[model samples]
Target: MTTRDALQTQLEQGIAALGLHLPADAVPRLLDYQALLERWNAAYNLTAVRDPAEMVTRHLLDSLAILPYVQGRTLADLGTGPGLPGIVLAIAAPGREILLVDSNGKKVRFLREAIRALKLDGVRAVQSRVEDVEGQYDCVTARAFASLADMLGWGGHLLAPDGIWLAMKGKRPDDELAGIPAGFGLRGTHELAVPGLSAERHLLVLGHA
Candidate 1:
């Protein structure tokens, strides 16, 4: 298989399974982003998934799994290290204005390069703590290592009154459910089926209570 066929086919199959409608160029551009990330990983150590095939499953497909939950015309990805769902979302579904926020200088550097290399328009990266981030967005996303309460506590204000928050979590975060602060209420909990990925994944949908 050619380089494209090797992982691109896998990604295409995964996308098909997820039933996401992406642009014709979306798959190619997604692979381009993956290649760029692989190159940067050697020096910057952007992500831990070192194997390219694993990258396709864990990074690209994992991000695309939540496309259905994303809403509105604008998005901000909090603690977007190397632009996981933000960059992936920008490629798969363009037109929305995107902000990728990360406190790590190295990851931000990789993100800026990915933006330019991918020619991802309407996407910007800012190096700031989520709480320090300014402006509101129609949608907000976070891949959780933090509990629901802490994540919302830091970036809750960034969500517009009518907006949705797509919080990606591994396994069901039942323990953290009760910790969801007062203002935000759980909208839905989705069990994500990621092709070739065995890890449990869930997307917590939250909105203003």
Candidate 2:
């Protein structure tokens, strides 16, 4: 199979099995992101997932796994290093507004290029600290940003009063949960069984209960 074909197969089985729908069109968009990541990594160090196939499973599939639980018309990806769940979700969801925020200028530059190259609609790349952005979002999704407490402390102001926080973690984050800020309540948690890869994944939802 071609490299893209293999990755698509993996995404189909892995993500679809989890009830996450990634259509055929998403494959090329992901391929475009992988290619851009590779090109930018030479200068910006976008992501560590070097091989394209690995990018499909580890980066693309892992990001798309959160689709089922992401219920929002607008989302802010805090500390979106090279745009994980944010950019991928932008492509998958189409009409949703996605704002990818990062402190690093190079990564934001790469994200902007990826957005343009992929022709993603309703997506914006903001080069600023998470705390610096002044806007409300229906949801704030992040992958490997910081501790759950820190994430709430920094991105809490950006979330609308009714907004939810979708934080992705590897393994159950007991310590981080224990460190959650006083007011932000934990609504629920979902253990994601990603296909074609062996890794523990969890999504924590925080909101006013």
Candidate 3:
């Protein structure tokens, strides 16, 4: 059928493969967000993954895979370029105040438009470096933003005590594991499965040491 239909099927199957259920409107909203990003990408070059089908696997499903570990009522998605997991998470599961942080002006502008166009409540986007942004969140997320040590070092203060940090990375970051800075301990590492994706994907969970 059409390309959009194909992407829709891929997203649906991917969600099921992850053994997660989403609200009826969730899927449509997700596709809408993708469309919006795609339009903006034409002008801003928001993300490297330009293919719609690839976006389904690399962007949408990859983000959805971490849904189980996204705890706490407030979450800060640092270096959330074009709002990868942040926007994806906000759509997949409603509620939980989400802050999408990025240093890029174009990306943040795109993020705001996406938030409003999607009619997403409790979600906001800000243009600021991860380190400059203030306030604590019950959960913090970084998608390969920086080294384990550097990411925690810059944004570690944002994570509330007993909060969880979900660092999304490809393959197990064995080398960077040792660099996890002081006061932050590795909670665990989880392998994520995204349908139609065979490449390695891992999520490093961290908390107070």
Which runs of model 1 end up more than 4 angstroms from their true locations?
A: none
In candidate 3, the residue pairs with backbone N, CA or C atoms under 3 Å apart (3 or more residues apart, or in different chains) clash, namely none
Task: Please write out the lDDT profile of model 3 over residues 20-110, one tens digit for every residue.
Answer: 9998998889999998988889899999999988898999999999999999999999999999899999998899899999999999999
- Model 2 scores worst on lDDT over the 10 consecutive residues at 15-24
For model 3, give the 10-residue run with minimal summed lDDT.
1-10
**What TM-score, computed on C-alpha atoms, does each candidate reach?**
0.98, 0.94, 0.98
* lDDT of all predictions: 0.93, 0.85, 0.93
lDDT of 1 by residue, 2-35 (tens): 8768998899999999998899999999999999
- Candidate 2 residue runs with Cα over 4 Å from true position: none
RMSD of each: 0.8, 1.5, 0.8
Each candidate structure's count of clashing pairs: 0, 0, 0
**What order do you get sorting by TM-score, best first?**
1, 3, 2
Error of 2 at 24 (Å): 4.9
- Name the 10 consecutive residues with the lowest summed lDDT in model 1: 143-152
lDDT by residue (tens digit), candidate 2, 1-209: 98667766776676667776666687677777877887788777778778877877888888888888888788999988998989888877788888999999888888898889899889999999888898999999989789998889888988888999999999989887788888889999999877667889999999854
